[model samples]
Target: MHTTALVLFSGGQDSTTCLAQALSKYERVETLGFDYGQRHHIEMDTRRVVLANLRERFPQWAPHMGEDHVLTLAALQQLGGSSLTDEVAFAMQADGLPNTFVPGRNLLFLTLAGALAYRRGLQVIVTGVCETDFSGYPDCRDDTMKAMQIALSLGLERRLLIETPLMWIDKADTWALAHSLGGQALVDLIIEDTHTCYLGDRVHRNAWGYGCGTCPACELRQRGWARYSARDANASSSP
Candidate 1:
């Protein structure tokens, strides 16, 4: 059984929720992020903000929250065909994946996280890669995570579990999970602090969060918020 975790936190909704989930389950939890030369670099800032908020507001999780590490991978921008790293429009490719799909992004993140975990003496790696309501990113799939887990364990010569709490859930369910973990406070933090825009637009704030509302990331968040809020409202009104 894994008692300690290193969460791949991007300072986004899914990642923040994953951090909460890990803190709830593990005895100790650390966070890791990557500065992958994304056009939307605000995540690097928002991630820290989110971590600070969690530590301050949630006393139960404060002690377990440990050191946070960030890595800069300049190579992604150098090899970029994706809109996330380059000055390009978002569109689907002939291969059926979105232009926003950064090739080998999750894979590389996990590999590096594994190395960091080894150095830091962590037991498991947690990420918030969901597939049930995602934009068809192969790296976010269940099979890909499973394969990566096996590879990391074998390469490290030690058993390391890869935990994906959001893998089987959709966006609305993700919202519900956040509520369960940290209640309305966490939901408010996600809405006010987490950054998920592909364009990194922070000036315009929406009901869900800050982002270019039309971007795939924002669209999913907005849609999920609509469903979650509607359901919560109905539940509250029920006798």
Candidate 2:
């Protein structure tokens, strides 16, 4: 009997790392993606590619089993507020949550994922939410996740574990862990392949991927990349 796990996959750096980690741990790993009508449709495409590659690598893992994780794209488009789904321009908030916060997004996604996991008899669900590098999203915090876990258990009548492997890890540490786990190839694939910009820009200039590097997301990404590259270079140069 395989231990199945559901991954709340976003096809981004953290989520992709979580996917790889889940692959290493669970006998059967399933993914759940949302078409939350994000401004960047590129993410959805990236998710498809990630899934395809996973299937190519792990032929025994059923590729993408279960129902299509695609939710109602129109409803999300209709619901505004978050920059990801709405026409609102992204603004970098120096403090507090930003416009990118999709209200109740993770809650809804996890609730659906919980249902899926329960249906598949899987007790574990994995997500890539991080508190360290997270952009002040309330749902990314540990407390929020704990509360959601309780709510899910009570409301859904299912005992499921929402595993957040990168909840406390910063981006630099995430890169280090990926390098340590023979996931350098995967990391490179994601860095070069997936899109993470709140503005949907995807070109690395001055060691920045996605976004204009001037934005908060880009600033953090640039810092993380610099740290990782410098450490990796120093390690290589050392005798």
Say which candidate scores most in lDDT: 1
lDDT of each: 0.94, 0.73
For all predictions, the C-alpha RMSD in Å is: 0.8, 2.9
Q: Specify the highest-TM-score model's number.
A: 1
lDDT of 2 by residue, 1-239 (tens): 34778888877777777877777777777778888677777788877877676556545444434333665546656778677777767775556778787778888888888877777777788998888987888888899888888888888787778889999888888777766644566666666655566666655444534566665566777788888889889989999
Residue-level error in angstroms, candidate 1, position 71: 0.5
TM-score of each: 0.98, 0.86
Per-residue lDDT of 67-169 in model 1, one digit per residue for the tens? 9999999999999999999999999999999999999999999999999999999999999998889999999999999999999999999788999999999
lDDT of 2 at 48: 81
Q: How far is candidate 1 from the true structure (C-alpha RMSD, Å)?
A: 0.8
